[model samples]
Target: MRLNLPSVVLFALAVSLCSSPSLFGAEASADEKQADWIQLFNGKDLSGWTPKIRGHEYGENYADTFRVRDGLLVVSYDGYQPSDLMSMDKKGKKGFDKFGHLFYEDTFSHYLLRVEYRFVGEQVENGPGWAIRNNGLMLHGQDPSLMTLNQKFPVSIEVQLLGGNGKDERSTLNLCTPGTNVVLKGNLFEPHCTSSTSKTFHGDQWVTVEVEVRGSEVVRHKVGGDVVLEYSKPQLDPRDPEAKPLIVDGKILLDHGTISIQSESAPTEFRKIELLPLDDK
Candidate 1:
């Protein structure tokens, strides 16, 4: 004969067994959950970091344009005018290119980096038109000694970020190989490679950019949770004029280096700058 227990009793017994501490250890506390996150920015100060501006000394105070306001790192220019600086063009007029790069002190070889940025203020009229819609995050930055005394910018791999007009939509996460070449689809480029297409980003909105870098092979760029660009084996192409000098003595490839944020021509803001170290899984 079979013994049939009441359905309600059986259900109660099963529930009690599942909820018992013996079956599953105590639940994780709030502190345990927070351990997963690391604060890159303290939100109150700029400690554990340094800044580099164009005109000023390498480690001195940042240029007037780059500042912290309302708890956000703002690169603003309201009272400033382009006509005050020396010109880079043949016309010989002042422009924003005078201040080119603002680099961070810490460097990383392979890691996952995340940043949130937004553009502000109107575009400077009749300014350096080429750089009107500009700003970049440079990775694998080389030492300043490699550049000429008059050189204004660092030679690094730029993950070019652009806020485009509707008609000319360039991808949000594109690679602008500065002083280098990249291999894609099994072919070498002439040290100058543009993205196949651009992903359009809405203007004046905070966009999230992420990059997963691993040495000279397999670098990935993601925007808003989607993988937008990927490249492998970035090195100098001997054929290109700019790259020729870099690879002439066989010492141009970069495997690991520091990261930097560019202050090209437009006013921009970055809120979150963080990195997560990756381990070989």
Candidate 2:
């Protein structure tokens, strides 16, 4: 009989996977030729991207949240109003659940993804405190087609991007796992979020973040060409209720998936989104 994993044995397996030396798979040759960068975002339109927003249909661009203006891919909240954000339902829940993601049509496995972004203007009023200047690159994500209408976030690994508040030190390119977990330094890391070593980028200055992903073997986050964080073995967290249905053959290994951008109430802009394939992957 097949057993549902939420048991102690599942926890043990996670630990065992962390200790196994085979977890560190063979590395690619240094001289491997790289392919030319493929631009995922066309500076003119959102042609190849689809919007998935909470409380809306899959293709509904709710309130025009994601748009291209001034030749930049912008996440704007200009269409939202005080009533739109504050209106409540019978359950006392907020009516306008505007969390959104703009996903590229194609999926990727082994590649180096780069994005040039910056936080701008103010966040929508009454936005969550944790989401101020907060946005993310959702990597290895579940297909938007499978997500429920009310699902707030996709099941994926988030490379969180944050802007410094002009004083306190806040690092960009941080890691956030919504329905997943990863191995860090030969141990199973189950945290919801963790910081990188990148320097704080204050104001509306542009910041470039590059993520090198090798299937499910490893993932590295870089800032200014310096690698700030490294981890491996990104798998679906069996304990996550949202991720439970995605488990197959009791296997949680994530070999590849889609990429997307977050619109978590913060106004942000992306000037470039490009990818470089590795070897033949």
Candidate 3:
């Protein structure tokens, strides 16, 4: 049957609407475009992340080391117990020395990760001396299965989040190389811990830390809107047994890897963990 020009146009329009709804229907709002920021934590469950702790299996949590409460991700020490003091401190006791890191399930090359965290409650009994309100975000982290059974940390560059004591000047968004190194000021800096220029954030206040990463090229640490630290060329340390094998051509540039949050035997909470893709690579 022969159809009128208007009828033929109407049919084509219907097909196009079904094929591309956004173009034919109402345009996507600005809020929808910004909504591309992916929420890594679901706020109600740990669906896309896994926990790995020293002396435990790769997937095993080793006593609920990480959990979600009140829409916040909490790294707790109530799961670990000392064998020597099992019965002596039955009334009120907490013992945890294991260093655990909660890792994202997937790996990415270049992206922006933003997270908000705060130190809360008290440190677990007999926790490490340096772990008082201590935690970090391990970017370009090795896979949990690759880490040694007793390895305390993975081969990654850390955007260390340090909460300040009530009276001292401490900086957050610091760069820490557990098994990696970076270039700064046109030199190969080899410090294990590099402090950021961020101001001291004291008490149990929420602090937002944003990290910008571009494969093996550059990484920047930001607090709020200000970039506190910037570095380039993440390479593995050849001297470290756990790190040497990861080196590439005597220089291991971290182009793509996992991301993780630390469980340093301190009580900490994370409200938002999100990422934005910068490129296809």
Instruction: Output the number of the lDDT-best candidate.
Output: 2
Clashes of each: 3, 0, 0
Estimated TM-score for each candidate: 0.76, 0.85, 0.83
For candidate 1, write residues 128-153 as lDDT tens digits. 66565567878887654355433555
User: Candidate 3: which stretches are off by over 4 Å?
Assistant: 1-32, 84-96, 248-251
- Candidate 2 at residue 56, lDDT? 84
Which pairs clash (backbone N, Cα, C closer than 3 Å) in model 3? none
Instruction: Compare candidates 1 and 3 on lDDT and give the better one.
Output: 3
Arrange candidates by lDDT, descending: 2, 3, 1
Candidate rank order under TM-score:
2, 3, 1
lDDT of each: 0.67, 0.90, 0.85
Give the 10-residue window scoring lowest on summed lDDT in candidate 2: 25-34
What's model 3's TM-score? 0.83
RMSD of each: 6.0, 16.1, 7.5
lDDT of 3 by residue, 1-281 (tens): 97667878999988888778567656664225668888999999999888888878888887788999999998886656575113233446554447889999999888888899999988877775677889999999888888888798999998898998899999998888998889987789898988899999999999988899999888989887798999998888887889987776765887889999998878899999998888745
Candidate 1 overall lDDT versus native: 0.67
